[model samples]
Target: MRVEQQPGFVLHARPYRETSLLVECLTRDHGRIGVVARGVRNERARLQRAQLEPFQRLELDLLLKGELATLRGAEPSGAVMRLTGDAGLAGLYLNELVVRLTGRQDPNPDLFAHYERTLRRMAGGEPLAWTLRRFERDMLDALGYALQLDIDANSGEPLDPSIRYVYDPESGASPGRPGDPHGLRGADLLALAEDRSPDVAGLSSLRRMMRQVIAFHLGGGELRAWRVLR
Candidate 1:
């Protein structure tokens, strides 16, 4: 197969054998891909060393054969935003989420653009909570699991901002049920879905709600970076 260049971001990478790496990348045109970079651990392997850092933009050349491709060439297309402090941790969290949720060999250009924009925003020191919430919502939507926030899932009517509601992972938002596992105030839910800054209390409650939703979808595996943030 011929080698072809694709713009991508390194989502995850781990040392392979003695000198190579097994890398997972998210690309604009090709979505997620797995490639093996031979001899990337060598100090003299300049090209491989430079292109393997997470969050950096890269132009990668890979063989088009097999499910796992062989890396032919890689170069930095541009500098990546350097996130620090809480923002940095949040960036890692986002990367982990993408790695978990996105499928290999699937094209999701719109999600890729969102990921790029989100990285820039996080690097600029936006509130990590808000940034993560937005990204989670968008990623779910892109993956076809969009939550129904604008209307009641059971009643089929517009959400009543004045009334409390509960988010059921399987059925979306509905009026608060007495024995539900998780619930949120209508105002907080509305504010979160609308990307508005709710009060601290509301924001805290919304985080819990979103977390339950995310965890349910993730099949109960804890997010390691979130633990760091907490």
Candidate 2:
């Protein structure tokens, strides 16, 4: 399959053989893919080294068949982009999530859009916490694992903002479970569910809850980027 000038971002890259690179990319229409860019590392190569790094929007020319594709060329499709400090870690964390959860060639246009927007917001110095939460929610929705927020897992009624609750990853929110380590207030959960502004108090709780949810779905796979933040 030959593709030309397709828009994508390198999620990760590493040295392959002497002068080539193994690149993992997330594309607008092709989801996640792996590619071999031959001889790009040589001194006389025409491909821009700047465009091969992760988290930048790139237009890639590729020829793919089974597992890996041959990268014909790549160049930045937009302005230069960078993510540093906490934002960088958060971006990497999001990348890890996408790589782990998605199958090759499984297109999710919504996930791609959310990822681009989150990176833009983070690059612009917006707070990482809210941006991450929003992305996680959108990602879960797109992946068909969205958190159950509108109704209680047990009572089968609309959630009440006044009550305390515990979230079950496979299930949803239920009235507090005894000795439950992760507990959230009904109001905060509702705010997060509604995509409204969450106060500082609610932010921490929501983060923990989302982490638990993500971990459960991932079968406890560790995200090194998340550990760096903690």
Candidate 3:
């Protein structure tokens, strides 16, 4: 398969052989792809190396034969989002998630759009927690495991804001007993569902819940970005 001028972003890259690089890119129309960039690490290929950095929008040319595609050409399609500090680390985490969760060559335009927006928001100084939570919510939806935030899974009743709930990875929110350490406030979940900002405590609760859910989906594979960020 040959693709030309595909809009994409490099999720991760690592040195391969003597002067080549192995790249994973997420594209608007082609989900995720594994590519080999020959001679990208050569002394004279600084420009190619720079264009392959994460968070940069690229127009890629590819030739796919088998499992990995050969990166024929890459050029900047737009300005790169300048992410720094924890936001930079968070950006890596997002890339790792897409690489781990998404199937190669599978198309999910919605997730791609959410990822693009999330990165731009992070770079624009939006609250990291809120942006990440939104991405996680949308990511799960794209993966067909959307969280049930408004209703209690066990009782099949609408969640009461006053009540506390424990999120089940498989089923979603259920009423939690008083003093349960893992309990998340129903209000917090509701606020997240509606894309409303919650208090610091609620944000923390959502973070924990999302981590748990994402972990469950990973099926025991650890996210290295979590280690770096933490």
Candidates in order, TM-scores: namely 0.91, 0.95, 0.96
Query: Candidate 3 on 4-103: residue-level lDDT in tens?
Result: 9998999989999999999999988888989999998887974468879899889999997777899999988866799999899999999999998888
Best by lDDT: 3
* Model 2 misplacement above 4 A: 177-180
What CA root-mean-square deviation does each model show from the true structure? 2.0, 1.5, 1.2
A best-first ranking of the candidates according to their TM-score comes to 3, 2, 1
Pairs with backbone N, CA or C atoms under 3 Å apart (clashes), candidate 3: none
lDDT of 2: 0.86
lDDT string for model 1 (1-230, tens) is 75576888888888988999999988888888988899989988856566688777888898866788888888888666888777777878888888887779899988898898889888887777777777877888888888777788988888888777888879878887665546677777777678787877777777787778788888987677768777
In terms of TM-score, how similar is model 1 to the real structure?
A: 0.91
Candidate 2, 84-163: lDDT as tens digits: 87888888888888988888888778888988988999999887888888889889999999888768899799998977
| Candidate 3 residue 30 C-alpha distance from true site, Å | 1.3
- In order, candidate lDDTs are 0.81, 0.86, 0.90
Candidate 1 yields a Cα-based lDDT of 0.81
Pairs with steric clashes in candidate 2 = none
Instruction: Give candidate 3 regions above 4 Å deviation.
Output: none
Model 2 alpha-carbon miss at residue 67, Å: 1.3
